[model samples]
Target: MPNGRDLGQDRGGDGTAASMIVTTKPPPANSPGKQKTVLLVDDQAFVRQIMWKALSATHAYKVLQAADGMAAINLMRDGGIKLEHAAGTDLMEAAAGAKIDCIVSDINMEPMNGLEFVKTIRVGMASVHRGTPVIMLTAHADKHFLSTAFALDVSGFLVKPVSGTVLVEKIERAIATPVALKSASDYATLIVPDVDTPDLYASVDAENEQSKTVRATDMAEQFSQQRPRFVAISELKVGDRLSEDLLTTEGVLVVPKGTRIAPALISALKDLSEIVKLMDRVSVVNV
Candidate 1:
């Protein structure tokens, strides 16, 4: 119920007042045994604290907290600040420079909402985590909200007051699922409308029964519209056409849409994927 400064009474384990920024150092960067890092973004300190406690309990994740979407973006851009234990034990020698594996964010927040943050990541081009999985947490589960969230490439959605166990499971699933398997249309289908709608075609036997038919030809025409198929660089073939623009994290355009894939281009894309985290899956249309 409380938003922002109104929840100042809440304090973390370090006796620090819950403010706009509250972060704990995770394992050091590049540690062979480092845990996966998850950015938990929410305006309410108490809610962040609850999720943090749940995540930390498992010792499986290094949790980072941000008050809102803007704060989360700033943290991502700046890498992350390292905080030492009260006894002067440095958990991180430098800033936690590890890439955020996933994000669990609340839909309602000030300055920039959760959906705005995701859109920024997708189009920002300069962001290394542009393709990172995002799990949205919302108090409202209306169809409009679900549709809008999926359009922005959200990986999963959880209503408020979510249990700790369920939150962890969702994070695991989000991270495990490849970017190629995430589809806006497929996710949107999860939101079923209240009105009773008949299947594509069915026989009606009501008092005022009126049977309607859908033309298979029209459906075939719609399906004929070439759709972009996402494939990993290793899976790319010579005849595939670029269905989406490909850009590096530095905002450099590597390949424009509509370019036909070639053997040389496939080799170059493979090299680029190895050099940066940006290009795991490329959208292409088969010739």
Candidate 2:
């Protein structure tokens, strides 16, 4: 089990948070090619060790452990690190090239907290693994915390004292589910072209519920009419907003209309251009 401090309790009737019971069991087996790559991030060494031991019990997974979010980013972005087995043996020297299937991370930590890490990967410029599923582990389940996690588009959330079995189950579910594709309605404008990914667009009603935080002025501005200017993707800047739906030659929706440009998104578009044919220029609002 993953350990954590209960925020609302002093179960011992003393001055300290209650301790958590740690447990471990062998992970379920899977087909040879079904073995997944998992990244576990936590500030505590003991938590990382227990979780790693639980996951590494079988050949069902190739696990990587990091003490904090920064370290986790390094492991995913840079690679070239030595992966060690539970028996103090070198499991693989080429772990740097491995693709991570899912990530389990704690919310609280120093240098880079889980929330910051999630935002960086999901929206940051150098994020190659932006679409990777993430399962957040936290001691607090407050409303604000949950809303932030939802906005970041995390795959799953778990409270502390989570069992290895449940963690494994969540990981499997997250990996099996494709990342939710953003609908044109999710933004201020609808520039949908020909989307062929799937029919699994998120419900507009559900999105509106989560979007309660949008300011009244912002809502008005979205409905406001503005002229559009065609700008080359290479010249797209951080503050520019899309005025039309950005699509690939195959009808895949990339960046939606009215979405603000970011450095990371620009880089991602450039890289995507090599594989798929994106329009030479995008239509942006003429602010």
Clashing pairs in 2: 1-23, 80-96, 125-264
Best by TM-score: 1
Clashing residue pairs for model 1: none
User: Total clashing residue pairs per candidate?
Assistant: 0, 3
Against the true structure, candidate 1 has what lDDT?
0.57
Candidate 2 per-residue C-alpha lDDT over 152-212 given as tens digits, one digit per residue, 9 for 90 to 100: 5567765567677767777777787655434323322211111122221222344565564
Q: Where does the lowest 10-residue lDDT sum fall in candidate 2? A: 189-198
Report the error of model 2 at residue 152, Å.
0.6
User: After TM-score superposition, what is the CA distance of residue 255 in candidate 2 from its true location, in Å?
Assistant: 22
Using all chains and alpha carbons, the TM-scores for the candidates as numbered come to 0.54, 0.52
